[model samples]
Target chain A: MTGHPHDHGHAHAPAAAEDGPPSEYARLGRAVREILVEKGILSAADVRRAIEAMDARGPHLGARMVARAWHDLAYKARLLADGTAAAAELGIEMGPTILKVVENTAAVHNLIVCTLCSCYPRMVLGIPPDWYKSRPYRSRAVHEPRSVLAEFGTVIPDDVEVRVHDSTADLRYLVLPRRPAGTEGWSEAALASLVTRDSMIGVSLARSAHEPVETA
Target chain B: MSDTPLRRHHDMGGLPAGRVERADHVLAAWEKEVDALLVLLSRQGIIRVDELRRGIEALPPDAYDRLGYYERWIHSITAALVEKGVLTQAEVADRVATIAAREEAER
Candidate 1:
């Protein structure tokens, strides 16, 4: 009681209710769900299944797709034109999503985001991780990709160009990062070890197992 | 004869943004839910198997066919419903209207 102010000496009572009730995002999601059910576009069971599939096979499928694109050139071209067919080539079945792959080359660095909403390539790339849906990343990634990539520890040189793709159409995107050096004779599986999820999203470059993943 | 003063460029009215993030969020949630409902109803023997199959068949092939596993099956039902007239365009429009109206009322 002498020097500093006595702040919350009662061991800090439990926090009060949230400032404003449900967030806008939650409200919107609820309203949309109601509309979909009423319109016969969606059902409760469908949501459950989607959540399940997202947990089970989404990431593995994305990893496999990235691996395949790394090893094959002709297949990569095919993927660019038609992602669904390309995915099928690798025997990764497509349910109903028509995915599109966008390759990132020496000159162009491709980034993907759904400006309208989170229209990720779930069929191929899998359900986007939570970070992709965050407001700051979602809003800024498209507009300032290089800066974002830098934050992720993959800095593109001044000469390199950056192109951000907004996944609004039925098509989705996956970045085919340029092949890394010193791994000339490596097998496809070995090459695949380097294709991190962040790399596939064009936010960072792929790194070998030897190169430690930089903490965010 | 007097002439009317020219309208100020800054005074012109503006339309709202074409795309609404909140609306998209809701619609996406709805689409997923709708697709799942059809699948569940079909599995539960509530909706005819053939009818569900028909609905799935009605989805846009380019988009739906590329969907993975369950989603493919789900969208198929959406197509079938559209074809069977179980889910009509007018019905969808009406539902959207209702949601919009409710939102306006809340505001």
Candidate 2:
């Protein structure tokens, strides 16, 4: 599913030396990784497998969870109660981190951020978008969530109370967006088609029934 | 930005910044490699996420500001490995130089 189109550019391109060599940091990282592999701390094949594992997961798993919650009240209650276990129910490996699902009701909206570091629920969302780690998003998400959301084309009404969750600690949050109107009697899979990564991050809402689902 | 009493380098919630830009989700080849290395290191119990976070936080403010996301990860991962005595700075430097020379020879 498509995420909110927040245009925070990559702040730093991979650094290059004056003579067009790789940046010190990049070279150092490669050197250390190679040394570790040689020392038998890790193997090249292990690195390859890890990359494959991470690449296998994406927002589709989260969409499935949200879709199930939309159709099943019992599942919704469980998801809100224990997001990690709920995600595990669908065979989503959350690793060692905890997943906390926050609900957006008509009266209150929730936004997620990690002021200290980008502590995201990567198991479901995969790697955080570059913008999510940008300085603007990290600072503004908690202070001016409304404006930030507005920048994403998600304008929350003035009457609604905005509750910003700063993920400073272990508990990572996923926003369970309020299911859109006109989605009644739809199958879970069909409803899941409306969920987007941005919506789960609480930066934007799910696509309305009228919007076409954009496949990644 | 300098670290303020209200906001540290890591404390970014509610600070005034700029607009979020839209970009492609493409990862550079080196980035993918580093990403894999990070997961592999963590999975092998060589470093914990908390330890990695601490390493990132320990970076100089200017470096933290200047580095990209995966750059920070690479920096922290390297630091963690060194701090844990898994790899020494001298060895890493030597290896980096060797790799650079090898690449130059190839070119």
Candidate 3:
């Protein structure tokens, strides 16, 4: 079950990034990159800087935003109203991407997927997980969402309707998981620790008050 | 990639597929380079993200399956540059051969 069992039937890991050699396409990438630098189309330093900047981002940024929303209702209203502007308030660059934050309520559980390539909230969550770009997730998430959630060990009760958001290149979606119970009066940093990347993706819920928060 | 009324292959929403393999992996070095290249390209207005997706979707079904996420991306990036007349096909081909030979000699 590692791969999609669709028109193509095989079981492969989503991304064993370093398992193989530098493929022909890999060499092509290097060649293209070198060519670009040689012609001054883009400098090598620019590429390095871009990578560093992209890698510097992660779910922690999204966690901070979510934690703030939980602590302040006004921020929550702002986040839902214009995500790009709200993110700017915290200095998270949305650039040209229009951000949409969906909240999970008692009656509804939201899941986000990019059926087209792997369009994700990279500004907030960094790079998406490899499986998020895999065929299975792109294919099944919009249809059998409940089953997909179940596979991720997230079970939404039948009473709670599952809403699957199909993201596009113009807009990206992030799920603000419901604040877990027993977290009353928690500090913002402590509350942020409970927001995992998967919870933001809506594959699972935020860590509960009793769940061990990773201090690292 | 187009404003086509028809559905594109990448548009796989609601389709039947296998179970999701809920896992994550650190990106490979080359993948990061590819990612950076695309980002710079977009920032430089050389290629838009939508154009990249179009190039990716235009890939033959076999190559689509054979390559990983960034693998497909490199091809698209290369194609976009060539399309923009920024780089020629022969130059890229020759450069790839040279790089491959150098790597082989180093090994």
Per-prediction DockQ? 0.07, 0.49, 0.49
User: Docking quality tier of candidate 2?
Assistant: medium
The TM-score of predicted model 3 comes to 0.91
Worst 10 residues of 1 chain A by lDDT: A1-10
Off by over 4 Å in 2: A1-21, A214-216, B1-7
lDDT (10s digit) by residue, model 3, range A1-216: 112111121121232336357688767877888788878888767876787888889999999999999999999999999888889999999977988999999999999998888999999999999889999999999889988999999999999999999887588888988999999999999999999999999999999999997775
Weakest ten-residue segment in model 3 chain A by summed lDDT: A1-10
- Please tell me the interface RMSD, in Å, for model 2: 5.2
> What TM-score, over all chains together, does every model reach?
0.53, 0.88, 0.91
> What does candidate 2's lDDT look like per residue over A15-93, in tens digits?
3232145667667666776788778887667766676677778888899999999999999999999999999999997
Candidate 3 lDDT: 0.85
Q: What is the lDDT of residue A46 in candidate 1?
A: 64
lDDT of 3 at B12: 80
C-alpha RMSD values across all candidates: 14.5, 6.7, 7.7
Candidate 3 retains true contacts at a fraction of 0.83
